[model samples]
Target chain A: MGEKIKVDRVTKTFVVRDSDQKGARKEFTAISNMEFSVKEGEFLTIVGPSGCGKSTLLDLLGGLSTPTKGRILLDGQEIKGPGLDRGTVFQQYALFPWKTARGNIEFGLEAKGIPKREWRAQSDHYLELVGLKSFADRYPHELSGGMKQRVAIARSLAFNPDVLLMDEPFAALDAQTRETLQSELLRIWEKTKKTIIFITHGIDEAVYLGQRVVILSANPGRIKKIVEIPLKHRLADADIRSNPEFVKARHQVWSLLHEDEYAGLYI
Target chain B: MVAISKQVKSAKRLHKLTINPLLALQKLVKQSIVLLLFFVVWEIAPRIGLVDPAFFPAFSEVASAWWNMLLSNELFSHFSASITRSIAGFGLAIAIAIPLGLVIGWYPIARDLLNPILELFRNTAALALLPVFILLLGIGETSKIAIVFFACTWPILLNTIAAVRNVDPLLIKSARSMNISSFSLFYKVILPASIPTMFTGIRMAGTGAILVLIAAEMVGAKEGLGYFITYSQYNFMIPEMYAGILTISILGLIINYGLLALEKRLSRWKQDPTV
Candidate 1:
């Protein structure tokens, strides 16, 4: 499978107040000349520093916001605002607090106008996929942070969208939980074979999960380099940590980030 | 350290046994004490001549008047009349406010055109329109009920508009991405989320309906608690007037509790987790 979604020369800028001038607004660029494409059923992660506008790029692809310039195409069609083909999972769980886990997962299918009987089976299937079958009847507040994030992923995937866009879904969890959820997410990705574009601030997460890691620079975020992962199958977590080549890639990415950070301060 | 640990364990057991029962009794005993204090003051005020017995009837006199009203079955008739009017008027308001609010809230042009007019009318006292309603509808049940409807509608309409307008943007975006579009969006996404807030408005409208009913009855109606109070005052039946006031208070309490119970049942999802 090759390239289900393509972004071309996407640029997004918001108006900001000029620091030196009183009451004067200036154009502040968030993302400039950003270009990428997700191969059909490929899992990719974009990793960068805090203000690199990784989220801005995700929103553009997810169709929550329109790019100021250029275009995004899915299956050779120009992308418009949010469509059913692309599903997004936010950093916060964003599940409806009023709905139980089952209710929330079924929301997408409900909107699709599926019959009520079908919703029960479909929703329960996805609930079990995320290992929340036991807690299906429970509300969002009933779950811990990791469980809530799992529910969010289940909700996005329940509708069987063509592309999944996730914006740092597990960043809020503790270190141990984050690692666990990362592996769970990889497992889900492998089983489902859905095209995924994940945004993150963590280097380890990007290297661990991505077929191709797109490193972005801060201040008018642009792609600095694309690092391809050669390891094809699941490697032991300890083995990946101990590999000499993995250490080299980590250090190389760290230095690139350092350069971007220093350059950003002067700007 | 061993002795200290044993003492802490015993204290924990003691706490488990006594705390729950003590909390329940504390709540009940506190309320009972307040009521007892009120009755004590009421009984003493007339006997001590703090207030003259002629104008301010004794507690026993008011109690006897209450018993007489109940025995005559007149109190029940007045209570029923007031309740029917308030409920009918409030029901009418709900029928009108919901669709109008949705239209106005969803469309910016409609909201800009209509909102100022709504704000103007809401601030205008509903009782001030009583004479106008009487002039138009001829001082009968229609005029009185119209007044109650006018008073009750504003809160419901305003709250509907607010709840619709203030739905979280993130939720809407999330819904749209999931392919939830215009019509289903309102019913599934907007309406369910807005319900808790909308129920707040409904509760307010319930109170407003009862309040306006009382005032409306004072004008020309023959069969409500407000009319009974006015009639008693006219005939110099001071104790009976107090009895009517007491009946209205209990009626208000019942209506409030009824709406609250319904709200709780409908909004189980919003139940506070801490409790």
Candidate 2:
């Protein structure tokens, strides 16, 4: 019950049934022999190619589904199923379409039977934290792509979960909005300092957001490397894209990825 | 170019205001005209000898019979009895069907187990089983209510299941991630999402329940509009039968309009994306 989380040699396999009339089933290994530990108050990112099962690993860690083998531990206790300790934000902005932004944020608290007066104050606070105070009454369909995600983040954060798990939460947003929300997330992260595990297919985003970025292989998703950033503080959105160290680290990761594809750098 | 586009937008706005309202007015006017034409034809056709006067009574004759029934309070008694039975059956059906449907839809195992039995029972038409209901419960209020319940429960149950099953999985995932429990999950998330569709089911059930009760009342009912219709027809009072028919249709229209208002209130958030 001391450390934040530890993924101990987790291996997840899916039985992909063959569409051929013969009715054969084949095993598709999603994550194999994955081992990692997330420290308390750490921001860790897992990044790889689109089909690399980065999301699957997050699901495994969050106990959305069980792995075929190995176990994930949160605070040295084995994770069994979805619990109050870990909160998730889905990439597709999974805000309930029927609920207003304030309602969605208040839902978790309401489930716990929190008094209406307290829930109102806390929900408003989270809405303000995500800079979506004006959009409190708006439904998911009324909000823009970015606004929906901000509300999603607010809902997850409102419960004050021990660990925050994000699965490429900003991937669907336009580039400008993505970066703006990234900085907003950084500000929120600084204030809360909760343990976070973010999964992404975007390398630059992984490097920018993570204190340590863990890269995984394509299929049979296995951990390849973990790169630690030297900086103590997150860079400003403008500064992040322009910083020499950020650019250099990003290029290095890009080359490592592209090297697997083409076997040589062109420039 | 921007100014021209803005001016074009304004022009389009004006065009919409002029044309859309006229289109809506035309629709309303057209419906009213069709109703007026039907009444006029009915009024004139019998006198002009275009159709048999025996089968088709004059509109004036029907209206006079309606007035007579109203003055004698016979129509009120029949109407009130029919309405009470219909509403009571509908309320009971809703009480049973909605919770059961939600359970079957929310849990896959329950749906898988119960679906075959439900489908088999649903296929047995409520009218065809009227004799069986009469045998089991006697030819009383029990039999009539049983028939209406059978007719009404299917639509409500099926619609509720459809609504619950079709609720977007994304919403469920979001709610789960927020640590919402299994019980509150259904009420807070699933119920709200399923309401518009559930309303459609209940409204359909309301009309079906009334129709079934009318037929049921024809079989041994002492006090109901259906009995009044058959009694008048047997007595060779064509206008009274026509008045009963008109009353039933008006009842249906009121139920439909009431549900429509409720649906509009509940689905305030579901705006057309194209707009």
Winning candidate number (TM-score): 1
For model 2 the TM-score comes to: 0.86
| DockQ-based CAPRI category assigned to the predicted complex of candidate 1 | acceptable
lDDT of each: 0.83, 0.83
lDDT score, residue B72, model 1? 96
TM-score of each: 0.89, 0.86
Clashing pairs in 1: A3-A39
Give the 10-residue window scoring lowest on summed lDDT in candidate 2 chain A.
A258-267
Residue B169 in model 1: shift from native, Å? 0.8
Question: In angstroms, what RMSD does candidate 2 have relative to the true structure?
Answer: 5.2
Candidate 1 lDDT, A18-96, residue by residue in tens:
9989999999899999888889999998998867898888888888788899999999888888877888998888888
lDDT of 1 by residue, B157-187 (tens): 8998888999888788778777666888888
Model 1 scores a C-alpha lDDT of 0.83
Interface RMSD of 1: 10.1
